[model samples]
Target: MVMVEVRQRLVVGISGASGVIYGIRALQRLSELGIETHLIMSRAAKITLAHETDLKVAAVEAMADVVYSPDDIGAAVSSGSFATMGLLVAPCSIRTLSEIATGVTSSLLPRAADVALKERRTVVLMVREAPLHAGHLKSMLAANDMGAIIAPPVPAFYTRPASVDDIVDHSVGRALDLFGLRIDIPRWRE
Candidate 1:
């Protein structure tokens, strides 16, 4: 028998943040594009999902091609040889960023991110925090130094978004752009 890998893979980590929608939307878009997604969501992410939308945790998990628990330290994504495009932490929380920056991955989310960094794969962190202090900025710098891309989901006023979905979709699309995935989002025109 012969085995062949088909769709490209990307690890998606949904941390506890105000904009879990970014992670959710990323899953939706990736599914539509036939990209294999490996998902890991923190406990706080599940709680945030309940607060932010009507969807159940299982519903959100169902969006991904594969799912891992935060406590699943031995999950595939926790390894540097997993052969994924990389990890993407949509709506990355400050705490998660600190963990990844410090190389102290207590959960699978950051563990996978750290592994991706060590493997020189693209790790995109959609940081959702604002009013950052020196410490937060320092962590971001540290993560960047480690080769992780800190892409916060800031809206492009140039897009002239009409609804919150438009802004969220655009942000998620832009983050996926880091992986060389060209989503047909509104682009800046001259």
Candidate 2:
């Protein structure tokens, strides 16, 4: 059982959203916890990381045990037999959300997420859009119904973070908790 838990794999998907650091932080925490990581970043996400964050694609990709090309739909992650615990779409773009919600598996990210949902594993989407319209909300509801946890990157004032990394870590930590990871971070008490 210990080996089973230790072998638990996490799939991290980076989308073309503003908060690329959240995905990177999640990968760092997963590495520290001895969890195997499989990473997939959309082409647009690669460009967004360069424009919005200082970290290079190779640097971020290094955190994962395996990295899949976003264009490769036949990647291991896209198959249920790959046996990942689930996929976490940090900074999940609205575009990606719509694709996954509607069963569009053109890329490895959505295909992997689809496999996760079918396998009844946790699929957490750290949605990063604001001022959502009706269509966006509808898409989110569809995804939710399909067993994906819709996690928006909303700040938690209760954490009282002093720096941007703190805020990012808090959100990433909470996301990890969904997978039963006891990451060491401040939590609100009753």
Candidate 3:
């Protein structure tokens, strides 16, 4: 008998933040790398997509290998035992950050993040809010204390990105770097 190994899987969460494009780019890059993606989007994320991008919700969902409803707490990715490389909440909203920090997940997106943290797996949150107040800073600090990586999608000017796509791709590529998966992107040189 022959045994086949399971492909590497990643959990992608999109929250109601202004940078929906970041999540979209992540899915595209992950697909290019041949990794299985399990996606979950908060209700607010769908609305944000409609407002910010031309892509429809169904189009985004189709990019993932699997999709789960925000309210589906019993979804496979919600469990630590599901065996994902990590969870990346691109454009993570402040509300989602607070929920993960306090371990009070009300939706699959945050719950998957919590599960990743509890398992000591990588949980990268690309928090999108600017003009951070003390409360937001504290929440980020709390999440960091619990083993989550607070990776805001700050673009690397060193790359000299020429377009908005370039900037978004650079940020998404850098976040995926945390998982040790190297995708094709411009890198800084000494």
Candidate 4:
């Protein structure tokens, strides 16, 4: 009998940041890997998706195995009892970042992050703010201190990406590498 691997669960939270494509690509990649995904989209993220991309929110939500409402603060994700391998906040806005960093359990994202931290599970924050100010820096520091990985979606010219897709793939692959998943990509050599 062929043994099948039990897929791990990942919570993907999309904030109202500029790079909605990053979240989309991440969800696609996770699906391709056969990992079960739970998705949440902030109101601002919905607006950016409508304004910046041709894909509808429903279309994006269809990619995930489960989709949770952003305003549903009392959802299962907000509880630590929910078993999840990790949480990733793609295109994390400054507001969400600040809330998570300060231990403010205002919504699902921050609350889920808190659960991940207290449980010692992985929490990757792909913060998308630019032209950083002192406040942003401090919030990042706070999040870092609380065991969150601050993964900004900065471009890497070293990969010699030919298009936006390449860039997205590289970034998503790097994020996956954090969880020890091997995908097609060249490692950064010394």
User: What's the lDDT for residue 60 in model 1?
Assistant: 92
Error of model 1, residue 51, in angstroms: 0.7
**Tens-digit per-residue lDDT, 1-190, candidate 4:** 9986666889998999998988998899889888899999988999999998999999999999989888788887788888788888888999999999999987777888898889888889899988999999999999999999999987788988899888888887787777666578656782
Clashes of 3: 0
What is each predicted model's overall lDDT from 0 to 1?
Answer: 0.94, 0.91, 0.94, 0.87
Better of 3 and 4 by TM-score: 3
Global local distance difference test of model 4: 0.87
RMSD to the true structure for each prediction, in A, is: 1.5, 2.2, 1.4, 3.0
Give each model a TM-score: 0.97, 0.95, 0.97, 0.93
What root-mean-square deviation over C-alphas does model 4 reach? 3.0
Q: Write the per-residue lDDT of candidate 3 for residues 1-190, one digit (tens) a residue.
A: 9987999999999999999999999999999999999999899999999999999999999999999999999999888778999899999999999999999988898899999999999999999999999999999999999999999999899999999999999899999999998988899783
Per-residue lDDT over 56-89 for candidate 2, one digit per residue giving the tens place of the 0 to 100 score? 9999998899999999988988888888889999
Stretches of candidate 4 off by over 4 Å are 1-6
lDDT, residue 34, model 3? 97
Candidate 2 clashes between residue pairs 3 or more apart in a chain or in different chains? none
Candidate 2 scores a C-alpha RMSD against the true structure in Å of 2.2
Model 2, which residues run further than 4 Å from truth? 1-6
The residue-by-residue lDDT of candidate 1 on 10-108, one tens digit each, is 999999989999999999999988899999999999999999999999999999999999999999899886799999999899999999999998989
